[model samples]
Target: MLTNNIIFYSDESSIKISVNKDLFNKMYQYCDKSYPNETGGILIGTYLDKQTAEIVAVIGPSEDSKTWKTRFNRGAKGINKLLKEYWEQGIYYLGEWHFHPNGSPYPSNIDTDTLTSISNNSKYSCPEPILIIISGSHNCYNQKSYLYSSTGQKFEMNC
Candidate 1:
């Protein structure tokens, strides 16, 4: 069963990430499968307001993705097709989610750079993207989410 809602807040913004409990469990399962390696996926949802959004689905790592102990590079294979399908179902691309494997939930330099690049990319058309990082192994996982703006502002999500 899915929960009714999950709230993430900050001094500057508040977002209601709507994810079913089943989906949330599945996300953890993905991390369990990856274990010591890194794993990531896209977040599919819709914006409710300027400072609010809903997470409807999470796409797991692709077969072609590159995963390592300290890094994760999401593959492009079939992503477009998946996005299109989700779009048809009224779910838009909101941002990304990944696991840190054996690290903290804090975003690293590479993570920051990736968020900046995503915000700046004309193809994405998302000036602000949400990032969710799950740190630690399956036995003891810690999750943190953030919102990164194109102007280089980062806000930690408080749940």
Candidate 2:
């Protein structure tokens, strides 16, 4: 049921990221299902080169995830297993995606901090990670994509 793909790139034109339309729709569904509460999950995909990457899958929030009207705390339950399975198939963690529930499609301070931590965390093994934030109601949504460097610098990508 997925069709088309959304692509984004950094202003310096050094990074290109793509996501399947279906996966976006799926994210919207998760947001809608969560209603006034916030929700999010991890992005799974592969990098084509040093500057281009494609997101192939989206994992919904785990059962242990906590949501609030203005904040979300993604849980880690079962994520390691999922990532391992995808790794065996040549895919891996690309980044994170979250819903803002009628808020702006921008990274909040906490969001930025989280991405910084992920980028610096030796466990994730990703020096640069992407963060996608979707904002709005059920069918009417807006999104912003950012790539975070290990130093915590955020680069907003144009869609």
Candidate 3:
């Protein structure tokens, strides 16, 4: 079979997420404490994989929101500013991270639909589109990180 050579960028698969540990800790903590209500944000960085948005850092919503939808919309707005920063630094917004309170850290119905919309909205959205879900099991730290494509297909990061 003659197939085009598939060369995924290396040297980054082993790179531990450079996102501020404190930030991840906070997200993880929030999810753990807010079981059932999902908490989520975006990860920005210069990563090789499209879906696995290397997690250069984690951003959360201000502590006043009383609804998931509110926080989610706030996060979307906040990410626009962050995206500008990433562009200036030649970095990219890889993927999103959210918590699945008391549930598996995988894309739920809303998540799949949301990411599907993201895919349609941008050209940068491509292969390995990552959507990380930190379950109530132990926040984002202990919770598993699942990767999903723009088409709502799930996969695993090289890590």
Residue 112's lDDT within candidate 3 is: 71
Question: What lDDT is reached at residue 108 by model 1?
Answer: 91
Candidate 3 Cα RMSD after full superposition onto the native fold (Å): 8.2
Please, what are the lDDT tens digits per residue for candidate 2 over residues 65-91? 999999999999999999999999999
lDDT per residue for candidate 3 within 19-59, as digits (tens), equals 44555576777676655566776656665443223455556
Error of 3 at 24 (Å): 3.4
What TM-score does model 3 achieve against the real structure?
0.64
TM-score of 1: 0.91
Worst 10 residues of 2 by lDDT: 1-10
**Best first by lDDT, ranked:** 2, 1, 3
Q: Which stretches of candidate 2 lie over 4 Å from their true place?
A: 1-3
TM-scores of all predicted structures: 0.91, 0.96, 0.64
Worst 10 residues of 1 by lDDT: 13-22
Query: How do the residues 66-156 of candidate 1 rate in per-residue lDDT, one tens digit apiece?
Result: 9999999998799889888888887788888999998999999888889888999977767788899989887788888898988767889
lDDT of each: 0.83, 0.92, 0.54
- By TM-score, rank the candidates, best first: 2, 1, 3
Clashes of 1: 1
